[model samples]
Target: MLNVRLSIGISKILLSAYCVLGAAYTYAQSQRVVVTGFTGTSSRVPQEVDAAGSEPVNALPSWEAKAWKGETIHNQVLLQGGTQQQQVSVTAGDLADGKGNRIPQQDLSIGWVKYVWTDEFRDGCGYRKSVDFDSSLVADRIQTGTNTMLIAAGKAQPVWVSVRVNANAVPGDYTGSIIVDNGKKITLPVKVTVLDRVLPPPSQWHYALDLWQHPAAIARVHQLPVWSEAHYKVMRPYYEMLARAGQKTITASITDEPWGHQTYDNYPSLIKWTKKKNGKWSFDYSLFDKYIAFVMDCGINQRINCYSMVPWKIAFRYHDEKLQRDTVFTGAIGTPAYNEFWSVMLRDFTRHLKKKNWFDRTAIAMDERPMEAMQSVIALLKTIDPAWKISLAGAWHPQIEKDITDYCIASEARFPDSVLIRRKAEGKNSTWYTCCSEKFPNGFTFSPPDEHVWMGWYTAATGMDGYLRWAFNSWTARPDEDSRFVTWPAGDTYQVYPGPNTSIRFEKMIEGIQDYEKIETLRKTYKATGDQVALNKLEAALNNIRISNFNQQSATEQLAPYRSLLND
Candidate 1:
């Protein structure tokens, strides 16, 4: 959250963010449109539109009105660490002056000011997506993307307003305004009264959702080569979104092709391996550097998971420059020559990461290798760098738990309660992952958003520190229209679309993470004050939650009633 506003050229970033919305369309040639904001639910806009359209409508939604009078709307909010949002429906009508004179064919500029402290106007306001959730909290959340859009003369669109108060924001009343230019001026007031409390930074967050990213998918979506700047630009938003969701590790590919079906096909290698004239092995790591830097720049700086040390099947080719031919290298785990090659490669890679000051946070990742193969791979890796962190995404290998830095076990592994509890107590960073096997609580579009939100709560309930899903943006071939691939459910291939715009499932998952944080925060706060009664109440709130019950209420709705406990 703290790293979000590091300006990489605000205008350039805005252009990139608004690329989907084409250049500003001319509004002068169209009939002037009236815009008004009103309280609304997903089902209906609460107020009737003014047909007379004589008065300029409020451009900003009210943050303090007691009731909606159709002409003005007001709602108040309490500051929280996570993001909080409210939507106001904006309707447009034929423009007219208060004197009932119709004004037509004019262009208007649109803009909004950072919510100032009305009292201390210099203090800026940021936006948040969840209530007191560390991950989505932003120090500067009030800025809108592509500030201008043309409103047709008799149409309506919803202007979603969101606010976030950072963990350390000073307590006071803050005010801001959203201005809609229609040749005539209309301003809507926004107000916030920050309470005297601070949220812990993300380092204290307990829920970890490992959203694995597919850079190749990004390249395909943008029609660019892997590691190209164009690819990085399109991929930045996705990684940043994950970072905002409290993702702790960055997933990277060294050379293994993505979705290779356990064999090489359309997937291209990022690591280039070459066979020298003297029969020596050489690798080019230019691609890895570009990708790692790209992800780090987007705020995924804590850990790097370079997947994978052991690929599904070890088969790679090296080109012979002198002979002008390619030689495919193939071997099973523990083949003397293959082991030697990987030992050298990993040694070089470890040295590279150390040079970049990334060795400590780096892990050599593997996916679903057999226990025997995993042991062999670990042995080979340790020969190169004894301190190298080994990460595996598969069933738990009890014998190798001590060797693993992060073990993402599948749900079907059915790890016993004792083992799970022991792992947590031992300070081992482990988690659970779901793929084709997970059904009820999943990220599919058909599934309720609550399931996504339930993930964080479930993880906490089960004594796990995080959750993991294989595909971040592993889009289907027809990603725009469908999310399903041949091997998995329709939405299983990806939880988000190409724009890096989120899906309902993703939104709900965030809600769950926020809820998890709130529960943990409440427990910590009560414990610190030695209030056993309040602590028991907080525990009851968590104990009462169930994955099956999530569908009954949206996460926000269910969590709202506990605000008194949280506020106190």
Candidate 2:
């Protein structure tokens, strides 16, 4: 009887312990990290509850996206050739056991989405103002650096998953998985379908994407001396990124603060000017040659645009050897001082460029100057060398249209059919540019992400050769943290971040450029095959891509049917 009682007691104790252990295991299993996928176009705020006072929802179990061979597809599963990105949100459910003990967070080994503070403005255009606007933290920056993400209980973290599809990738379906280890391994499957069509490599692209560069900003952001070896090293990745986007023109400054110190960083002259004791001017082209070679080597060999026969301030800087001091020449346009000042430089520059075999590809570039000033500058350039090229990005002036070799007018401006035809026939390049002036169809951070992509299609539809913007990396004081400036809307001064990080704006813009390339390629192919039906279909689709359509329809909606037509 005693042995029986002891056996029953032991069995009861064992059963009770078993039940407790099982319950603990079940509770632990319930506290899993939930992973959800979202479209790249949708900017999700980093909050546990949304503005609707409810938790955000996604039906996807794992992240999946599709794209073409050379396009960069965003989180929306839109297709592209270059890369496919999926925005994922990882949320930690009750991170503790039933005992209410704190559970350690897991280290997420993937790319993170950085939230930047942005404001809601009346229009996407114009300079910065003190007007009251709704402000919030926006997810824009995609940091690819290896950083561990830890999520607290009931909180979520945004992850950026990008997969690059090579230019020569075979058109088919591809599959991968993102494994998140939070004590237990949770595998998220990723699916990508590469469309049959191919996007040409950036080098083969004809789009003249001229995003004016600011090397000085790179140096400042990296805390290195301007033009230092380390600075160049840091700048290499940035320029290479531009090259990958099919950049055509090399922005070279010939005078200090060429835009009259409009940007945060001063635009220093690449060619050093010095007035000798004998009163003759000479230029040191070492920096100019190095920079041009550097950019050309990076595959931007189309045109070396030396800035300003007409700077905004009209103040030229040169070292006065006799006084052993730096001097500034305030010579107004058309003045003898101005004419003589540029005449010597132009003559010497022409000789130097010819010797380097770069004269044919170099342009005396100007930006947003008066028509009279442009006429005088063009006359001076022509007087020096009839073969000298002149590039201008400003209001359209028909009088100087013939003289401008690479003319980029404002986005609101249009060249007459005759002018476009004549310019094309004469082998001249015509493009369009957008600044803080244009509200819709601009690249401001507050602007819709699709608007950037829309600009590319608009270029093709409007029969423009390429696109131009005033600033590429003219970074603000804290570019990675804040994109706001006193002169322009947030993110107006820079397209990218300091870590050489790319933003949603930059990536989408590149996608549009790729679209432009694909369109050009398909147009030529259709022409070669004499497929008027397909050509007409493509043309009709482009015709519908007007700014009016853009306002009424989302870029995805506007581009979908047309993109499918191209794919077919």
Best by TM-score: 2
RMSD (Cα, Å) of model 2? 8.0
Please estimate how well model 1 matches the true structure, expressed as its whole-model Cα lDDT.
0.58
TM-score of each prediction: 0.67, 0.86
Residue 449 error, candidate 2, Å:
1.3
lDDT of 2 by residue, 261-374 (tens): 988887899989999999999999999899889988888888988887788887889999999999999878998988998899999999999999999999989999999998
lDDT tens readout by residue for model 1, 1-568: 5455556467677887686454333333233444445332112121123435433334324543211011111121111111112122222222222344321212111211111110110111222122222221011111234544443334433343334444544455545554545544566655445556554445446676688777777787778976666777788888888877778888877755633542111446657777688867677878777777878888777778876657775666557776879765667778897797677678778777898888988888888888888899889888887988888789877899888888888865655678777767766677888776555566654444456666666676666778888877777665545443444444565776666555445645665676567667666778999989988877676665555554576544554555355445
Clashes of each: 14, 11
TM accuracy, model 2: 0.86
Locate the minimum summed-lDDT window of 10 residues in model 1.
Answer: 115-124
Question: Ten residues in a row with the worst lDDT in model 2?
Answer: 77-86
